[model samples]
Target chain A: MTVQEKSWKEIPPAGICWKPSTEYLTGDWKTYKPIMDSEKCTRCTLCVIFCPDGAIHWNPGKEDIEFDYDFCKGCGICANECPTKAIEMKLE
Target chain B: MFSEWKFTAKDIAEKADLFMSGHRACAGCAAATVMRLVLKAVRGPIIATSATGCMEVVSSIYPYTSWATPWIHTAFENVAANASGIEAALKILKKKGRIKQQRIDVIAFAGDGGTYDIGIQALSGAVERGHDFLYVLYDNEAYMNTGIQRSGGTPHGASTTTSPAGTVIPGKVQYKKPIADIMVAHDMPYVATASPHYWRDLITKARKGIEVDGPAFLHTFAPCPRGWRSDPSKSIEISRIAVETCIFPLWEAINGEYQLSAPSKVIALRPERKKPVREYLKMQGRFRHLFTPKFEKIIDEIQQLTDKRWQRLLKKCGIV
Candidate 1:
């Protein structure tokens, strides 16, 4: 038997629906990215608080915060409410 | 009469303390209980892949971990794929005589969001390839990890954050995806649906799946107190009502033969079934608007559809 197998076709995520509680944007989430500006960030932690998946993280020593796009849903609450022009949305 | 039976020492041994008391799940999370039960049924070297959902978040919060086993967390849609990699690696290692014992079982744990919606194709492929692994779908009806979001497993006529009830529209508008039937359609080695409410039936089915040679899939109806808007205390009762009302029938399919574990318990009338659904809905802030007629019709439709499906299941089980 060959060790190589057929490549798996990526499954699309379920689109928006109302019947269930929340319509998670399923599909390839990797296509979108959440951009954060450390220069303008006040470090109030609003993005961290509002993020559902806990994708944003803060570094205490360097005073730099990071948003891991691997899990970010790109809901835009952070960019919408950023006290400074810190967070921006990106589609990768 | 049932109280006379005592839990034996061997039973306790079989039931390991994999999940100690201090783990942080919701007040009444059926999925947490399910994790305990599933881990108890399997021993030896095993790797578990879980999608991003309530169970993953609650059990594996950063800086605090609840699982005693080697578990991996990937994206929501690739749990099966991750498990496939783990299984393939283990298989190749065992075949090459590199790993001793060679008894690791690859398993994937997912909620309705990961299983029915995002992860279906990968899961289908893995099962179709006949990999020796297990997949457990812990269906809480909707996506609870993201603050009661809707998913494919959400039933019709239930109000969710997306499908709110008002004077004009009430509750969700679609039926749940028939995932079990879909799996059986693949002609997989084993397929079964059980609920934590039925412990003996669930444990038995898990045992059966473990013994099966090829791929196995188990769909579990796990209720969510926080998401379903039900009292924390009534989590188990609501799960029982779900089966008793025929909302979920416990059954198994082995090599295309269908066998129902038990008959759906029939109640007096629609009102009896409606009582628990209503009680469950009323406690949650999400369904507070269902007092109007639009909401009433949603419940009515749900009751009607469940009754029809229950009858069909009975026919399938050769009861009617």
Candidate 2:
């Protein structure tokens, strides 16, 4: 969504931000994508803990980890730090 | 006495996200991870205040904020002061029956630049006054928000824009200031040094800090890929190696009594298990110049200093 142009007086006083940053999608910054191999996964959740973006999730229903590509910047940290090498970074 | 909160990975996963995704933090930014873990440990209403630093700038761009809780952005030197005021106001509101919540956690976050140098006065005053808040310093070891400039927390032999490595001089000439020890000297109820690599320990310490009645301080080692010239994906690895090398030991002080944390405790007990400082430096490009033959003495000096500091810490903890 385009940011609406506002006059200086229209802006919130003291620069208060009313919206949550989740509205901004950062996945566009990805040059690489983290692909997970369920077979090799240990479900250790290190990626979930270390993810700077908080984009990785532990899906209780599937009993496995999942990635939210909508916000993942493809840092390759999950792939790099995965002990079992379950996650791999592939070109976007 | 504080009962430990044993949080598993699943438990953390199930919790609500206080620090949301899609913020502008760099990929593999360990400071962001520090913020996430700290927020995860606390339950109930939270009022977070951040000094002017990378986390503040990246998380709260104009019009959007990563924080789900009430957050205030303060100047570089007064985050703790701001938290102090918030805590005071909250106390008054609760006493007057204006606020319904029985308790509110006030947390202040600052980078090494703000905590170690610029904001040290405010932090000291707030802690000395015994404010009911937790001051978390995500120390990246330099002024990373502006540029790679050396801060008081920057270790010896590390290169930055201000302390450039050259033939004439090595990197930073001085050693890292003992900010944790300084905080402990304030006689606060809780003070801890943590690293993001050890999330459980960090989370537990954060909880204790929040639960304590008086002021608490947490110095967290945050690796900056851009500033340190390290691979972004290797941030955790670097953090782990730093602990293993005894350069940044994980330890805490309760009521002025020091005790090494699990990871650092093991190394302290079995000194042989400790990795060489070279292993830690090799991962980051900031110390690339130190690998040269001419700077061999500088590397040895750093290793010597690290070992000395480790031994000193062991003594402080009464391990030796």
DockQ, each predicted model: 0.02, 0.83
Which tens-of-lDDT digit does each residue in B20-86 have in candidate 1? 3334456556676677666656746678888888787876543345666677888988888888888
Deviation from truth (RMSD, Å), model 1? 15.3
Worst 10 residues of 1 chain B by lDDT: B1-10
Which candidate has the highest lDDT of all?
2
Stretches of candidate 2 exceeding 4 Å from the true structure: A5-11
Restricted to chain B, the TM-score per model reads 0.88, 0.98
Model 1 per-residue lDDT tens digits across residues A1-92:
12442333432233211121112222234444668776787776545433333345555566556675544544454565466858776777
Put down candidate 2 lDDT per residue, A32-73, tens digits, no spaces: 999999899989888998899999998888888889999998
What are the models' TM-scores?
A: 0.70, 0.97
Query: Which of the numbered candidates is closest to the native, going by highest TM-score?
Result: 2
- In angstroms, give how far residue B14 of model 1 lies from its true place: 6.8
Write the residue-wise lDDT of candidate 2 on B1-320 in tens digits: 79767779888876767999979988879999899999999968899999999999998998889999988999999998999999999999998999888789999999999999999999999998899999999999999989989999999999999999998878999999999999999999999999998989999999999999899999999999999999988998889899999999999999999999999999988889999999999999999999899887988999999989999999999998
